[model samples]
Target chain A: EAEVAQSPRYKITEKSQAVAFWCDPISGHATLYWYRQILGQGPELLVQFQDESVVDDSQLPKDRFSAERLKGVDSTLKIQPAELGDSAMYLCASSLPDSTGELFFGEGSRLTVL
Target chain B: AQSVTQLDSQVPVFEEAPVELRCNYSSSVSVYLFWYVQYPNQGLQLLLKYLSGSTLVKGINGFEAEFNKSQTSFHLRKPSVHISDTAEYFCAVSDPYQGGKLIFGQGTELSVKP
Candidate 1:
């Protein structure tokens, strides 16, 4: 029954502002992920972490977005100079190990940039 | 590379009616498939997954899916649905070689009318 935890269920900010979303994965999980869910579309991976090391981030917009799992447990995703198109639900998920193919997600933080 | 496709953008059904959500994928290597449900204002929840062995996998809330490797399809079906079942469903695929990075399809919204 352990669930991934996310903070600030809703966020609103102006363009060019900075915003951050936080997530705490289930205990013992080793892989963490950050995804963006635009309205009317499925979630897209922004970054992924294996423990404290970044595994994949090829799709991440590095110039504007950054994510880190400092302790290999909780993670934070930050976006600087937010754009209107950046408005979306930021979801965090975690799994026990790679290739499990089962993930537990947190109740995403919905961001709106004006 | 792996990609998923959800054929229906939306499916409307009355309460207690059976429903099926179509999902397909294209992959060059071995893959795993998963179905996730998202309630309004909430994060994604794993509905089911197909890793190996069984062609038919049963998941939470009485939902099931069959993995057709030949057809590259993994369709979700439920015997009966309720108003609470109204939400968005996403189909995703991951290549084993990619370390479980998921590629998702455009979601299918299931509107269970009362």
Candidate 2:
């Protein structure tokens, strides 16, 4: 089965440090998304990409977070000067352009800021 | 804009018992609904979805949900549950006008006791 892939399954860093998560969506998928799932809550969209272009990022905290799908196939999310509140599970998902909202997710990268 | 609400924060049930996880959505326009399951420390997995046509949608692991447009609800149900079913369930809505950006609910934790 073609699946979305994520790396650094677990990461722990002190506050004010830098952290990064990576994701590779399923081949041929035109839409990619990054979500954050805090403990005891559902995932929230942080950023979305459509063929290397950012479609939506209103929810993203641009002051500290940045994401890019350089090739439109794989993406990287970076957080500089991470805070304790930034600790969460970073999830990556993808779907075809016309999938109508069906998404396939990766195992996710869990981050913990001390 | 669209949002999802899961009425219960947690549901505890004995093994082999039937279970229902209530989900309600609010959207000014037609939207797609989905249910996703997340085991401990794992990424989300799609359970099912309601796009159009069928009011009742069957999904993996003997789970089903009914879309009540009049009530604006989509509740997930299972005839029998196992201890392995313990996990967090999330209800999400996606608006086509928003380029398929998904909005998730607060999540319901299902704890099936053995």
Local error of candidate 2 at A72, Å? Answer: 1.2
Best by the lDDT measure = 2
Model 1 Cα lDDT, one tens digit per residue, A1-114: 899999889999999999999999999999999999999999999999999999999889999999998889999999998999999999999987855678888999999999
Whole-model Cα lDDT per candidate? 0.92, 0.94
Q: Compute fnat per model.
A: 0.82, 0.73
lDDT of 1 by residue, B46-102 (tens): 899998999999999999999998999999999999898999999999887777778
lDDT of 2 by residue, A1-114 (tens): 999999999999999999999999999999999999998999999999999999999999999999999988899999998999998999999999887788899999999999
- What is the fnat of model 1 with respect to the true interface contacts? 0.82
DockQ of each: 0.80, 0.82
For candidate 2, lDDT tens digit of each residue in B1-114? Answer: 788999999999999999999999999999999999999988899999998998999999999999999999999999999998999999999987777778999999999998
Scored against the true structure, residue B71 in model 1 reaches a CA lDDT of 95
DockQ of 2: 0.82
